[model samples]
Target: MYSFTGNGNPTLVGQLSLAAGGIGLNVSQDGKYVCVGGVASANLYVYSINYINTTATQALSNSIVFGNSALGSNYDLNVRGLSGAQIEIDGLVNYDNVN
Candidate 1:
């Protein structure tokens, strides 16, 4: 995922992989971690993002992990960028736990 302030610029902000059985996902207020949910059940899974390298051929950008338990009923997961935000690929959404 990427984010921009106001102009149509691209900022590789974060990346997320759907849990094996996750459906919906969202970020916390501070943007430090992600909250995921299932499709048929009401469960929220928390994940943390990690950044390794800044300059390199294979620079480590973002990393995440599905939390232990699900936290809320699952819903459709959609990726939406801010004024200048964009995402490569959105994950699957429905009603299930993937962590």
Candidate 2:
């Protein structure tokens, strides 16, 4: 994702590797999750939004950002072995087969 600064200039912020180039990607209505539907792989990926608050002394004072924090272990359900499940190389999403 590319986020714009206060000046409205875009900057490279983050990325996710999916099973295939996703044609359908969206953030949840509640703004707490990101969803991607993969047609080629027949998969669904749900990612919890991670926001970090920076204090005044930090570079991005009083800002929220996608930090490099790991999701809780259960966030990625693939390891529990959903039947015939496939996980992306990045393992950044909760996996499920939409098909």
Candidate 3:
């Protein structure tokens, strides 16, 4: 993650290493949380954003791993509201002979 000043260049704010390959990302409207969806791992990761002084930080808050790994690729993630931590993810799950 990075932050930009009014007249300065983008600065590195925070970073998180995912356990698997990440294919989708979404930030909450309030800028308090971020969601990362994995492709091969078939997992959803949630992180909480915190600010100390002026620098930003991210901490892993939650994660869910789905049983169907084929459904992991090419997904889109978005926050449902501005005040809540709800997320909406939509994608195609490649099942055997099905999409």
Candidate 4:
């Protein structure tokens, strides 16, 4: 992820190893946190942002895994709240067997 200042200079805030598939990203209303969803890995990651001296730093705060089931080809993530305390994730899953 990157952060842009008023002068339009971009700075590397953080980075994560995402799966080889489409990924979803959302930022909190307060810009204090961000959530990312990995479609291929079926996992979610939350990061906290700290700013100092016009530089931003991101730290992994939490992670949630949704088993190995193959999530569909698309995913969407939405975060809302005063401090981004609420998160809603939706996605399509592919199921090959049912018994």
Candidate 5:
């Protein structure tokens, strides 16, 4: 990931890894989630971004040609929220929620 400043130069935020060669990627509109569609390993990795990216979940069990994903992790008051994932593979779409 890279951060952009007014100078128009991009600064490296950090580097993360995927299980296989990345073929497709998407960042959430809110900038909190990142997705990587990979070949070989054929897994869609969903990462939750705060300061460091954590593997929230993995989806799509095939050599993905193209894909997208979402992840959520949050807390407030004394309640803890569950993490979830949504993915759309080459042709099949699936939504999964985890607690």
Candidate 6:
């Protein structure tokens, strides 16, 4: 839960926890829309941006890792759309519409 306001350094805003065995992360274009998914399970997390670093900002968005609980060693973690790329599944288009 850290953020940087364009010029200044990063700061902690909040803290979130994943329910173990989480998998996917989808970020929208405007630093918003952070979605975390659970591995082989049915769960998702949505977060909002507090701040971002100008140089090393990726860590602010990529820190969403798998949790510890029923994780069982099978967490297929993956991140997508943080760069505003569109995803398609079975000819269906998916977009990060986070604001």
> Quick one: best lDDT, which candidate?
4
- Candidate 4, residue 38: Cα displacement in angstroms equals 1.2
Q: Give the lowest summed-lDDT range of ten residues in model 5.
A: 72-81
Which pairs of residues collide in model 4?
none
Candidates' TM-scores?
0.32, 0.40, 0.31, 0.32, 0.28, 0.29
lDDT of 2 at 78: 30
* Local accuracy by lDDT, each model: 0.48, 0.49, 0.48, 0.50, 0.46, 0.47
Per-residue lDDT of model 5, residues 1-99, tens digit only: 555567978665444455445455666655655666667767675564443223556643433112122333231112122355454446433333322
Q: Which has the higher lDDT value, candidate number 2 or candidate number 4?
A: 4
Candidate 3 wrong stretches, greater than 4 Å: 1-22, 54-99
lDDT of 3 by residue, 1-99 (tens): 555567779655444455545456666655655667767877777665443232335522333322333445333232233565475645322222111
Cα shift from native, residue 81, model 6 (Å) = 18
lDDT of 2 by residue, 1-99 (tens): 455457967654444455456445665544656666766877766565654444657244333233232444434333343566664443233233221
| lDDT agreement of model 1 with the native | 0.48
lDDT winner between 4 and 6, please give it.
4
Whole-model lDDT, model 3: 0.48
Clashing pairs in 5: none
Total clashing pairs for each candidate = 19, 0, 0, 0, 0, 6
Task: Report the C-alpha lDDT of model 1 over 30-88, residue by residue, as the tens digit.
Answer: 56667566756765555553323245555334333223225433432333455754565
Candidates 1 and 2 compared: the better one by lDDT is: 2
Tens digits of per-residue lDDT for model 6, 1-99 = 455589878665444455556456655545544656676777656655333233564334333232222334343333345456576544222222221
lDDT of 4 by residue, 3-96 (tens): 6567877666545555569676766655655768887878887665443232335522333322222334333222334464564645332222
